[model samples]
Target: METRSLGEHERSTSQSPRVIALANRAGAPAGHVVLSAERISKSFAGVRALQSVDFDLRHGEVHALMGENGAGKSTLMKILAGVHASYEGTIEVDGTQAAFTGVRDAEEAGVAIIHQELNLVPELSVADNIFLGREPLIAGVLLDRRRMVRAAERLLERLGVAIDPESRVAGLRVGEQQLVEIAKALSLRARILIMDEPTSALSASECETLFKIVRQLAIDGVAIIYTSHRIEEVLDLADRVTVLRDGKRVVTAPIGELSHGAIISAMVGRELAASDRGAAVQDGAVVLSVRNLTLDTLGPHGWRRTLHGVSLELKRGEILGIGGLLGSGRTEILESIFGVQRGWRGGSIVVNGETADIRSPVDAYRLGLALVSEDRKERGLHLYESIGDNIALPSIGALSQFGLRAFARERALARGMVRQLAVRCTGIGQQAASLSGGNQQKVVIGKWLATEPRILLLDEPTRGIDVGAKQEIYKLIFDLAAQGLGIIVVTSEMPELLLLSDRILVMCEGRQTGLLRRENATEETVMRFAAPGMAAWPHGTAS
Candidate 1:
């Protein structure tokens, strides 16, 4: 779709005046054109991803690439990254024809890509990860540990990230891991950098650091290809804009040439109903209750505190949203209730008039509870298993009898969930990893649905999926709620929370700051509660 539509599809803000500084850079003197592609076309198994597409990136310019999910943005970037190269296209770099054989070839050609999903060896130290393949060696044999550490520290400092080079990659949070990827790209001496949805999972402050780095890189004459679902970032960061729809370029213009709404029109070829945000419904009863929950000072890491004497309730036939900035202990709270975060203190859970002590996910499941984790690749699915296996995993215990694993019974259960969840796959036997992101997320949800839980915990349920799939997921959530399934949705997207939630709970710095009923919750109120620094005894007076 167009820029406006894309903005509406996803959604952004400003702190300093520098937030809008990219607009001024668009009018600056042009630099050399680093790469150009002519009539580029790519197809996968007879399905065309790019058709007669023409694109070029000028050195020292931030080129914001815009498209709806599955609109070929990732495909086009992959082509440049050499992940897919058997396509019909003519690529030229610095006026010379170029061909890439693989990702290594692209890296050698000074092209680097930071994907939405980070690629880092958790067991390795930061220094080792940055120089994973091309480690500095002494006498061309042994690894030069001191030199690598020094180099990594220097690079991280340059990128404004304060991290110890000796720390293991696993010790870092998602945002820190992303920064390491960037440092690795810089280590490659990359003249061209492609960042795909780099800020999608970032907190607001983390995004600012990333934007600063991008601008500095551009000023140093590096060509940047930026893609994200958040359109305002494009309007704020891109020197030029290009929109793609259904594998074709619709428009290319400078940032000043188009308004947000106009860009949206170009993306979808028409305007969407202005009111089509998400589902709207009210009047539901609370089925799950979490009261005064706390976890004793957690170790330094992903989330410091699971819950700070936090309390909330999820109603049957209602979508309750837990709103917070990333790393604000949102996911941890969900995990605690699901019994994944053990050793929680001073919390009582009341389910349908009965109190329960849930010490593990097994215990939670026995109490009719389920959770769809945020990290689908790592925590949500069995990547090596068939779709049937993953979907039936949660309910396998109940599906079997006489202490024996039953294959036929499992397949039957899988088929039912597959139909109910509307998972699109060639067959139930397909590997879970082979399915598209939307379908993968569906499988994740289906696994929980198979458990037939009266209470469901979803953390970033629709993250990294296409618009169509997002719509389907929303409908599914509502459908489950309509069927008396109590759901607690944890999300960073404000509009999504407002649209899908019957009630909203705002968390800031691991403390419950505010609560809003459906009738009174606005984006501003939620944000205010979510902001840090205030007396922590309930910011909202609304009942």
Candidate 2:
């Protein structure tokens, strides 16, 4: 692998505007345009999501759509994927103007889209998910199970993915589920493929595999629209880059003419400050401690231990990071600490030197502990409920009077939280489902802040949001730590773990493999402990 300083690249690219323009012109050569969108405009509820955005995809090229949250990247992709039929645009495929009525129409026109969220029924078999609507029939009336499995096998083999066709989708890992989504797209014989943040949940190794598959697909003459927040991945994978800001096209250039800083600047319309991962910080006394934590998960193969005597210490005014691959007990630790794990046992939890009895989330909260779960939609917020209601749910008792609900007090508390968190919304009455990803995350954090907890357990705090939102969340974490709150953050992004963590505890296969201070932590050093079967670090005295 080549080693190039992103800072140096940004400095050099900042001085070369003409190079960018030349690369943009050189992107699509003659007779190579496979798909083009002209003057695309879209609006929803009187708000413009996109305005006269023009984009083009060439044959055998990876065109990346870059932007911050609510910057119309997904809206524009939805237009191409036929998810939104009411948009002003001229779309041409194969040099002929075309209009799609729905997603089925787009698929029929040789277009397929893999959404950021995996859309599959977990109870269904892999084969059934791949050939869901258009299954092969034995005699036009009966379902051809054998032929469907066989066809699914062929698709998986083509992508170099190894998974059982007859296995339930629920049993597969997230990376495997992503491969299934890709296989489903390829089974449509798609000529144009749209991938939206395809690697948000994938591990480092799985990401490399997905990148290889993407390159091979491009080699096979498929035009791909790749969207991601990881700038390094974009730099490595994309052939051409198009940036959007405030719902308008900013620039389109080849990857060679762009740098990490240049692309970020284009996306946010400003030069972003470089992140300092090793900032100096003072560590206070241990505020939270766990000893001999273990959890058992019931599976088809019977009960199995997921956590094996995991232990860690979190200090007041300190950001503790838990780094590990998927299913490595990082999340389970949080769940166990929050008292939400069903079969967790043999754990002794101490809060501020007091042995705490946390039999449920209610008990955990009563003991000054709050957990911001990874699945915000399912666990953190009520999607259909009003924003004010979601914010006030956890603190209803305090806002109530004489065992009756105090509507006025509830509204006041909700308004204060919304303002404090800078949660962008029409009003407190706006449903949580209507807000953008970043604002929704803020609301989740605000809900926990309402509890006045001394310890915060955050699992993937900035999972699916864009770069701008991520920066805001990082600042929020720092602010919370400055306020003397003990924070434990579990994140898949290595840069995030290093940037926000005062000290990182690396886990592998349900064990603490290594612990390193912020100054000593690096991607390679962390991964050495995060990988399975790695040697464990020597125990250090609790600070």
Q: How far is candidate 1 from the true structure (C-alpha RMSD, Å)?
A: 6.2
* lDDT, model 1: 0.81
Tens digit of per-residue lDDT, candidate 2, span 1-543 = 111233443475564423433343355341288899999999989999999999999876789999998899999999999999999979998888889999998898888999988999999999999999999997799998989999999989978888999999999988899999999998998889999999988888899999988876765667899999899998888888999998999999888788888998998888877555345354658999999888888877988888888888888888989998987889989988988956747779999999988889999989899999998888889999999999999999887899999999889988998998888888899999988788999999998898889999999999888888888888888888888899999999888998988889888888888888887889998888887778754542122
| TM-score for each candidate, following the candidate numbering | 0.86, 0.91
Candidate that scores best on lDDT: 2
Report how far off residue 83 is in candidate 2 (Å). 1.0
> What digit string (tens of lDDT, one per residue) describes model 1 on residues 1-543?
001121332234332224334444456433677888888899877877799888989877788888765577888999988898788979887888879888998898888999998989999999999999899999999989999999999889877789999999998977889899999998998889999989877778888988988877765567899987666778888888888888988887888787777777776677644333244343565678889988755464543455688898777777788998876778878888878855545679888778988888889999899999988988999998999999988888888889878889999988888888888777799899877677899999998888888988999998877555677788888888877888899987787888788778888788888888878899888888878874574756464
Q: Runs in model 2 with CA error above 4 Å? A: 1-31, 275-283, 537-543
